[model samples]
Target: MMKGLVSFFFLLAGCHQAAGAVNTKTILLFPEATSTNYVSLKPTEKVLHQITVCLRSYTDLTREHSLFSLATPNKDNAFLIYFSPPNNISISINNEDIFIKVDPDVYYWKKTCVTWDSTNGLLQLWINNKRYPRRVTKTRSPIGPQMSVVLGQEQDSYGGGFDINQSFLGEMCDVNMWDSVLPETSVRVILTDQFSLTGNIYNWNDENFQVHGPILVLKDQYI
Candidate 1:
């Protein structure tokens, strides 16, 4: 009986390890990506929006153009990408490359980062929450129809066209989408560590397990 109790405790410990603590405060909650619960942001807001999606690499279609679809952080526009990996791990939006690289020293093993400039509508690259000093572009474009967001598969294309050997293969957590450009301090606070922001947050996990729905909603005033 004593041995059985010890074994049970060990099992519990393992379970806890497997189910790591997800930073719920930063987790964005959408209506399962199947409902009309998203908004759109276009030329008015231009290139500002929020986003949170999980990525995985385990399909046979070997291209990088049909794996994910995005809402315009508002309900006015949408974009889809069919991505296949191992060549250039980046997603292109408005002809700009928003890439992901793994840093050996950061918390996330591989972080998909792209910096958005609120002042002039530009982007920069940062792998694993580390910001690059230079801004990449300064073009502003209209985004999409804010509707159902898709993960693991693109909405229009069945299989992304590419090499068929590359795909996103991992779990995405703490997915968040913000409409305005977050300050450097704010990004560091949420990305580097775990904390809550006052008003600009769009989606957040109500619990660690993602069982609760997104409870916060605001107008497009964060920008």
Candidate 2:
């Protein structure tokens, strides 16, 4: 009886450790060449517009592509992060779009963070720990609660309507999203490849997402 009890306790401890290990594992996505390759997240109760994506693009900056998007059935409530042709990183919140020039050298394996608060209409972007000038937008209302979050493709409509020209053709990993804006220090920690803590809404390791098209799941090589 004593031996059986001891073994049962050990088994429970082992299961706990295994679960923890799985929760911290990161995944990499290799998108398709012609079709859209993406991971569709399960819809949560409320939309969390604050998001971060750590990815690398091997495609040339001359081509346009989308990295991620949180879309709604209504086009007016979507949020997107995409690369404009020739060398620009652009983001669209609701219906307003903002963009900035990107240096060619920093396109490899970078961490980009974006935050928006609908109440104050404050929007900010951070790349690899460097912060950009804050901009205000959409002060009148908050982002709608219904969101269809997808990676590697921009949603022109609700869940479908992917344009091949704006499809991502690289690797993505360590994606996260929070309902509220994270502190500057936490964003810096993610940039350093240490995901000790993460967002509450969509955490890459903890959440399950459906992969569409021909996307390949490779071992994360960057971090």
Candidate 3:
């Protein structure tokens, strides 16, 4: 009996640490919108001169919502993925907002990928295998370490200061982040299959991430 109790405690300890790749047929479901309900994603990598973030999300919210929030030190919006209403998707890199007007068909569940290169400040957004026109931002700063990545709530500060108004109310899964920007062909292949590529920085299969508030990890059938 004591042996089983010890194993149980070890399993509980695993729940709050680094996450492995359990996100395969699994989805991180944020069933409600609240300031406290969110998941904190830890990127194993530190410095990033370029970045590629890809994730699949399903939501019916018409108002503006935050899909991905990455905060570091004084730069609260160091790198963020935000959506407004029907088709306005904005990616904020180092507090500079670059908007991308996507097709209306992307309003539902879809796969989205965004890549940014600090060399020339080039940014590209791809949705459902189709790449939109790329844009150039003026911020070529390198994102340092100490990144606080959150899923549900947008962080006004480094790790705290969450507002319920911009909270995400839906399901998100297959979130992968690479320290280097992936090629266009690679992004196209990833849009077809979620398992085609895995993120070196933030692998979705890593099962050791922390869950705050009330979030559900359910199979695709439940979604």
The number of the candidate with the highest lDDT is 3
Ranking by lDDT: 3, 2, 1
Q: C-alpha displacement of 49 in model 1, angstroms?
A: 6.6
TM-scores, all models, native as reference: 0.46, 0.78, 0.85
List residue ranges in candidate 2 displaced over 4 A.
1-25, 47-61, 105-107, 220-222
The ten-residue window of minimal lDDT in model 2 covers: 52-61
lDDT of 2 by residue, 18-135 (tens): 4454343455555454545677887475754454444334444357777778777676226788877565778788767877775553446666788877767777787777787888
- Name the lDDT of candidate 2: 0.67
List model 1 lDDT by residue over 95-166, tens digit each: 454554423322233433344543455654444466655444444554433344444333332112222122
Q: Output the lDDT of residue 72, model 2.
A: 70
lDDT values for all models: 0.38, 0.67, 0.84
Query: TM-score-based ranking, best first?
Result: 3, 2, 1
- Once fitted onto the true fold, the runs of candidate 3 whose alpha carbons sit more than 4 angstroms away are 1-24, 105-107, 220-223
- What global local distance difference test value does model 1 have? 0.38
Candidate 1 to truth, TM = 0.46
Ranking 1 against 2 by lDDT, winner: 2
